[model samples]
Target: MARPDKVAAVDEIAEKFRGSSASVVTEYRGLTMSQLTTLRRSLGEGASYRIAKNTLVKRAAENAGLDGLEELLVGPTAITFITGEPVDAAKALRDFAKANQALVIKGGFMDGRTLTVAEVNQLADLESREVLLSKLAGAMKGTMAKAAGLFAAPASQVARLAQALADKRAEEGGAAPAGADADATDATEAPASADASEAPASAES
Candidate 1:
């Protein structure tokens, strides 16, 4: 590449680094085109692979405020994958490495933290972002449902109590209650009047 071209290439890589969540340095020394293609496909969506000159990548990393990444830009290096979620790219690369012997994962960074090979593997084992969101949504829905049930319990009890008192009054053959029974009957009857106001009105044609 020409001097100006090299500079532009370096600048372009730097721009990518600035925006990337995490970048994995891998040795694609012996990977065939088919193998690379398979690797790309296997990484799921939003993962990418590209060959980059180490020196340029190093400069980009430095410009992007990413230090300690130069160590990973070693010999026979060709691919730099980026993602919006730092762990996603790491996870994909780790899984790919597990299946392909030729593809070696040197190391990577996650949100400014340098990740070891093992760390990357652990990240891959984690549930995807979508799955985590769904779990949170389900939990929230369950909590809301429980709250609704709790809120309606007292109203339900009151309705049943009103029914029971009416049954008791009928069973007594319309005989008025005396003493404490009178007070209970009055209390029960008071709620029945209020119940008419509280009940939902049926639509009339």
Candidate 2:
């Protein structure tokens, strides 16, 4: 490649490295163009799979401030630059590799660390971002429902107690006050007893 073209290529790869959340380098030695096309389609628009020279990839990694990926860029190299959910792309690549024995998984980089082939496979096994988020939302909903019930129970008990107290007070208030009628009856009877005692004394005299 010419010097300017090489510079542009290095810059492009570096840009991809900087822009991506993760990247997986693979050896596509025996895979045909048709299979490559299908594999690219399966990865969707969230990733770009490109075949680049190892020297250029190394330079790009350095330019992008990434290190320790020198060994993964060996053989007929094609890198998958993933910007979206890493698990989904990893799954697609894993499945494709399983079907096509010609494609070899040559490790990867993600989340500020290098990944082994086994690690990449483990990544493929993880649940997608959507699934995990859905589970989180469901858990939150259940928690909120429990919290609402907890708050509502005390409020309902307080309301019932207030109503019962109000009813008792109303019943007490509607009748005469507790001791008024009893006191009046006692006073009237006392005067009769006094009159009876005076009559007996007058007759005796």
Best candidate, lDDT: 2
The TM-score of predicted model 2 comes to: 0.86
TM-score (all chains, Cα) for each model: 0.73, 0.86
The global C-alpha lDDT for each of the candidates, from Candidate 1 onward, is: 0.78, 0.94
Model 1 segments more than 4 A misplaced: 161-205
Worst 10 residues of 1 by lDDT: 196-205
Clashing pairs in 1: 51-78
**Candidate 1 global lDDT:** 0.78
lDDT of 1 by residue, 87-188 (tens): 566676776777788899888776787777777777778887888999999999999999999989998999999999989979786565456688988899
Mind giving the per-residue lDDT tens digits that candidate 2 earns over 40-63? 999998899999999999999999
TM-score, cand. 1: 0.73
User: What lDDT score goes with residue 120 in model 1?
Assistant: 72
Q: Name the best candidate (by TM-score).
A: 2
Q: What is the lDDT of residue 5 in candidate 1?
A: 86
Q: Which stretches of candidate 2 lie over 4 Å from their true place?
A: 177-180, 183-205
Q: Please list all clashing residue pairs in model 2, or write none if there are none.
A: none
